[model samples]
Target chain A: SQKIEQNSEALNIQEGKTATLTCNYTNYSPAYLQWYRQDPGRGPVFLLLIRENEKEKRKERLKVTFDTTLKQSLFHITASQPADSATYLCAPSRGSARQLTFGSGTQLTVLP
Target chain B: GAGVSQSPSNKVTEKGKDVELRCDPISGHTALYWYRQRLGQGLEFLIYFQGNSAPDKSGLPSDRFSAERTGESVSTLTIQRTQQEDSAVYLCASSVSGDPSNQPQHFGDGTRLSIL
Candidate 1:
């Protein structure tokens, strides 16, 4: 079976700093990977999607990089704020229109 | 204009009781998915619906779980004789169809089920 691995430790970063989270997959090579932000008591909201071919994707202060060679994807949030404090999840999927396989996720707290 | 909407944001029931969770996907979204997230755990895919038929149900945890969708619109997930372990937040998501791989999913806030 396929599995995803993310940073197990909670991350605490000061405001305005860059926060980077990692997602690694094993036993499968997906066509693309997605990142989502989830706050307490709420479902996850889509953030960015980076394909194996594209290598990198950016949206405002968020940037996602996909390294197929390492079967890993990195999600970066620039100019982080306290509002950015939440759990970040990564999903790796293939076959165009299919269900996503999500990682356990890393909880990041951006301190003010 | 609306995102996915799940009814009964919170559900509390006694063990062995049945519960139904509803999801209304975004208008015109052909793909709908259901997932479960236990406390401190990641999302677990429960089922996937394309239009009204399910193409993948491999993630359903047990025979006690079943789901149905009506013409790319509303979906209902029912748990029969649920156990205490069935307590978790049930989330619904929808996405547009087309591309071979890169479509983002819009998720609902989820229905929190507590089995006592």
Candidate 2:
């Protein structure tokens, strides 16, 4: 079965701690992957993009790692704040510039 | 605003009625897309447009759903004989280019459609 999914549906962590979310794919290898953050009642916001050739990408306190061999991507938020609570979606797509599908996402809560 | 814009943020209509939702993507963006997000579910792609043309309409759920873009800027999604099952947030997004490898999509707040 061809699928890209986040391992967890929801996760809770203490503020200032490091939060990690995982996305795994089967039966396919995507050339790149992107992560988005969505708040309730609002559209998703673009966060980061990682290519397969690259092992990891980082911006600010966020880091994303892509492993083609394992077909998995890990998104990390260091120094997480309560404001960081939101659903994070992962989109792994082929080189095509057409429609892009996304995983259901993992809702993260940073408790102060 | 410099971001994508969607009008009639909320709409309530009786089932079987025809409805139209409009989207104004950021100026200079040539790649536009529409998606449906049901409560507690992930977004489902509805359609994709590059400039004034749509290369992929396969994601559209049915003939009842139709969309058009003009001037490569504003797009409208019209659903005829709307059903209760169509109650969902309709989202619109646009990118500087069609390639996801290089561009990130900027999304609007979405239109919340309620079928009575």
Candidate 3:
């Protein structure tokens, strides 16, 4: 079975610090990985996406690194702020499946 | 332009009652998807629609749940004899295309359904 594991525990960090979240998968290698931010009572918003061939992708303060060999992806929020406090989800895409398998996600709290 | 939109941000109904949820995808988006998110859980894919092709209903939990899209526009998800387990946030997302390798999905605020 294909499984994606993310840190279920909440992460607390001070504002302006870097927050790193990990997403590990088992069973098969995904063609691409994506990160999303979801707030309470709202749907998820796309953050960044990284392909299997590329090592890293950056958008503003967000960065995503995909390591197919280890079947893990790392999501980083640089200079985080209180507004950045939300649940971050990692979804890996299977080849030609047209659907993404999402992980449980990690709750991140950036305190001011 | 408006993003994906769902109707009845909050819905409350009694068990065994039938309910319908609506989703209006982004204008000109060729692909649409539906998902369910339980409290403190990850999003579960429910179905996908692309162009005029047959929908992918592989993720539907049971036959009691069904969905339909017409003319590549609005979609409605119907739950017959809804059970308590059907209570969850139903989300709708739309993308430029159904190909996951390229297009990214844009989501709606979702309709939070509660069954008593």
Per-residue CA lDDT of model 1 for B1-116, tens digit only, reads 57899998999999999999999999998988899999999999999888645458899999999999988789999999989999999999998865425788899999999999
Provide the TM-score of chain B versus the true chain B for each model in turn. 0.94, 0.95, 0.97
Model 2 compared with the native: what TM-score? 0.97
Docking class of 3: medium
lDDT of 3: 0.91
Error of 2 at B109 (Å): 0.5
DockQ values, each candidate: 0.70, 0.75, 0.75
Model 2: per-residue Cα lDDT over B38-76, one tens digit each: 998889999988875644788899999999999778999
Model 2 interface RMSD over true interface Cα atoms: 1.3
Q: Write the per-residue lDDT of candidate 3 for residues B1-116, one digit (tens) a residue.
A: 59999998999999999999999999999898999999999999999999898899999999999999987799999999999999999999998864765567899999999999
Docking level of model 2:
medium
- After aligning candidate 3 to the native by TM-score, how far in Å is the CA of B62 from where it should be? 0.7
User: Per-residue lDDT for A51-107 in model 1, tens only?
Assistant: 779988899999999988899999999999999999999998886646788999999
- Each prediction's whole-model lDDT (CA): 0.91, 0.91, 0.91
- What ranges in model 3 sit over 4 Å off? none
Per-residue lDDT over A2-82 for candidate 2, one digit per residue giving the tens place of the 0 to 100 score: 687895558999999999999998888789899999999999999999998999999999999999999999999999999
Query: Evaluated with TM-score, which candidate comes out highest?
Result: 3
